[model samples]
Target: MDVAAIVTAILARQAVRDPATLRPGMRLDDLGIDSLGRVEVVFAIEEQFDLSVPFNANTPDAGGFDLTSVGSVIAAVEALLGEGRG
Candidate 1:
């Protein structure tokens, strides 16, 4: 699966924005993703990738996963998938 495409789609749904308009550097806040939306995004990603995402809605940075931007999410998911293979 295309990590970027999936992540972008999820973000677009939560942010109510167009997937084509979402850039790699765009922050989740910039996309208007609230706390609940953030949690939903994480859940969707976990289901889509069939892998666990180390995310805590309360302390987002406490988890190893990076949710800084669109690119960071893609990178984190890719890294997690690589770890699963290893």
Candidate 2:
């Protein structure tokens, strides 16, 4: 599946708004996603990709991937999948 489209769908669900508004450069905070929302997004991504996404809901950078922006999340997923780890 297209990663961006999947992520956009997930974020749009959380946003409860139009998915078209989400941009690659938009940060999670800019997308209005809080800590709890972030966790949900991660969960969706993991389930969609059928791969475990490393994410620290308590401390974002402790032992996980980056969730800075939509593009970043997409990149991380691509990297993992490319490495055959996902």
List TM-score per model, in order: 0.92, 0.86
* Tens-digit per-residue lDDT, 24-75, candidate 1: 9999888888778889988999999899999988888998898878889889
What is the TM-score of candidate 2?
A: 0.86
Q: How accurate locally is residue 6 in candidate 1, as Cα lDDT from 0 to 100?
A: 87
- The runs of at least 3 residues in candidate 1 whose Cα sits more than 4 Å from the true structure, single-residue gaps closed, are none
What is model 2's C-alpha RMSD? 1.8
Tens digits of per-residue lDDT for model 2, 1-81: 687787788888887768898888888888788888889988988888887777777778875488888888788888777
Which TM-score value belongs to model 1? Answer: 0.92
Best by lDDT: 1
Candidate 1, residue 52: how far the Cα is off, in Å: 0.8
